[model samples]
Target: MALAGLKVIEIAGLAPAPFAGKVLADFGADVVRVDRSTSTMNLDVLAQNKRSIALNLKSPAGIEALIRLCEKADVVIEPFRPGVMERLGLGPEVLLKRNPRLIYARMTGFGQEGHYAKMAGHDINYLAISGVLNERSKSGKGQVVDAAMINGVNYLGSFVYNMNKAGALFQTPAGTGQLDGGAHFYDTYKTKDGLFMAVGAIEVEFYKLLLKGLELDEERDKLPEQTDSSNWPKMKALFTKIFLGKTQAEWIKIFDLTDACVTPVLDYYSMPTPTPAPRLLRTPAKASASNEGSDVFLEVGGHSKDILAEAGFSEVEIRDLVAKKAVAGAGLEKSSL
Candidate 1:
């Protein structure tokens, strides 16, 4: 309801752009996804809470129809390589001129003007270039942030850039950073039942509580200081052996409501619903189901007539567009709009 009156046009692309549109739609914005006439993948989850209108961007009629929609849209989100939109005559420069107040958001792997702007890359590539991939867990495997390429390039910091300026941050091999698994107290361990537990007792008091909960207090005097990097492997091995003695649930019970900062690593299906932060009494966040219908997946141009009519096109014009193969929708011939 917060975005009840906002109008957004999202050019159909891959994961990130659709996700951005879905967030807007979830907040009550009228999000219309301009889908291509042909698409190879089904992105139903990302298409939830949004409407789809199939348009052939290669056609002049399709381009004109999109421009008309943008004239009234508050926002336009497009994900393409740097000159793609411009070549289609729908770039920010052209659209912003038609509607000066339009917020044209362009999503790409690299920025629009950089040397790597036109290069083909995905989330992993972006993370690698940004130095995020360089940091790994004790397993020596890089962690991936799905759909991170969009937010990472657009809003999130390039970690390497900050590290370069700070001068204190250095590139060691994986599992060598204080927080990136170099610290024994802040790593994951497998349990007796094959489940995993995440331990993050970073503060001194919390670390003390963790040791107490693990019943390793008797060996504290013999163990190296928590900040000593040289002792991490030994501490990690000891912790791993101790944790293997208990199931994930058993450890959770021991650390329940305590400052030990231990929790079971939940899988996707078992992940808990996090309460929205800064909880509001009014208009609180609520999850909505994906759009219903068999046509929800792998279908484009499902709302061509309705979208065109809403954009001030006449019935004759809509029919002509559809007939010309510039626009399409399911059962367009039978629709009375």
Candidate 2:
């Protein structure tokens, strides 16, 4: 609702760019995804609340159609290697000139200029070069990195950056950092049922509460100091043994509404209703009913004719373009095209 009137043109790509577009669409922006003529993966979840049009950018008519679409768009989100759009004559300079107020957002792995700019990469590769992956590496085995794209963006903030500038952010192996499972109170523990519970009782009072919840209060006096790195392994072992004695749900019930800072590690299918973030008292985010029918699941160019007509193309012109294979969509009879 906050972005009800905003118009966004998102060039279809992989996870990160699509995710950004999804966020805009979720907030009520009129998002049109410019998809390639050929379909890729089935990304129905990411396609929610958006329209898709397939265009063959290599064709002059296709490029012109895109430029016309940009003429009415407030934002263009392009995710490609450097110079790809420029080579296609649809780069920022060309589009921005048509709509001077346009926000041309270029999302790329290595950025527009650099030695790695043209290099192919995924989320893991991006994190690998940024020192993050290395910190989490274990015995040289590559683990699947979850949400690394968003995490990489957050790593640019002040805290980690300031530490790096002070030359204090030394590269440490996995499970060694204060908040990276080095301490017993700030790690995940397996429960009796084989499920896991996340423990983030970082503050003194919270740590005390965690110990109390675990019925380890009597041993707290004999326990090693919390900040002493040498004591972490023994404390972690103690915590692990105690935690495995109870199920995750049992632990959650014990720590709920308390200061222990504990919660169960939820899987995707088991995720509960999320508490709305940003805590907006008004204009809260609402999920819209997805467009119905198999037509919504049709590959990229599914809405080609409609999108073309909306962009000021006459019915005849749209048909002509489709006949020339400059655009494609489902159910476009030759007579209509």
Candidate 3:
């Protein structure tokens, strides 16, 4: 009901924009999926709660119709290549100038510039370009690498490959090893509130501390051997029962001061923001000392004069650039760049 009056114009695409429109639709927004006249994309799950329309963008009549619709809409979700909307005379700058309050969300992969900007891309292309495909590469030299989606996912389990050489130890059935989630201490348990708590007290000291935090240290002598694979099921049952007795927040408070390596399994948006990982030994990043905030969201050519001047352009050159429409947004202002 939060978005009851919101109207969203979704230019149909393969995945991203449709999913977003679906979410908006779910929240009571009026989402109209504008499919191309020739599109064969069915009313799939993403189109569940929305309406659809076919429009031939190439036609002047269709373009005018869409522009008129956008003039009355709140948001336009466009996921085409960078300049496609501008080429069709429906760019954010043009639309925003007409409606003034409309939200234009330009979605793209590999950004608006670079080699892949104009290329048709999918999930694999995204994974490969983002360095995710080589997360475990040891080679320092550049080399050609190729993989299908399935092969790329299978390679991520390479961590368990070394155990394959351990003879009898490797003979342990899959999903029955400690790190494979066979041990109670290295698994997730449901809490009273239906959320989950991840307990990974792998080390003996941490495990002991975990027991102390959970108030289970008194029964530590009665508990089965922590590393005995044969006793894993009973241990798992015991931990599961105990974990559900308290909410995740309660357990967090209990274990916050202990070295238990315990944490809640939070949903995507609810997860806490982690600090940036890389740190310099001497000049490591820290909270800014200044209280000043600098947030400047500029229009397309808002900083044209400033950018040219910073690049060593004279005041006369900046004026000429603006006069010639080579630069934009600055209209004969007294404060020259």
Better of 1 and 3 by lDDT: 1
Top candidate by lDDT: 1
TM-score versus the correct structure, for each prediction: 0.85, 0.85, 0.43
Across 31-53, the per-residue lDDT of candidate 1 in tens digits comes to 89998876545565577667889
The TM-score between candidate 2 and the true structure equals 0.85
List candidate 3 segments past 4 Å from native. 1-175, 215-222, 265-302, 315-337
The residue-by-residue lDDT of candidate 3 on 1-337, one tens digit each, is 5567777888877567776776676566777776664444353346645666555577665565567667777778887877898999888777877776676766676567777777877777776665322321254222212222333444664555555555524466767877767888899999999999999998999998888877776365587767888999888898899999999999888887678989889897786543322444553333222222322111222333443443355788656544443333324344544
Count of backbone clashes, every candidate in sequence = 1, 2, 0
* Model 3 accuracy (lDDT, Cα): 0.65
Model 3 error, position 293 (Å)? 13
Tell me which residue pairs clash in candidate 2. 54-301, 319-337
Q: Determine which window of 10 residues in candidate 2 has minimal summed lDDT.
A: 140-149
For candidate 2, lDDT tens digit of each residue in 95-203? 8778766777777777666668788987668766764223212342222112234245556655876885796553457678677678788899999999999999888
Model 2, C-alpha of 294: deviation from truth (Å): 7.7
Candidate 1's displacement at residue 279, Å, is 5.8
Weakest 10 consecutive residues of candidate 3 by summed lDDT: 291-300
Q: After superposition, how far is residue 99 of candidate 3 from its true place, in Å?
A: 43
Sorted on lDDT, best first, the list reads: 1, 2, 3
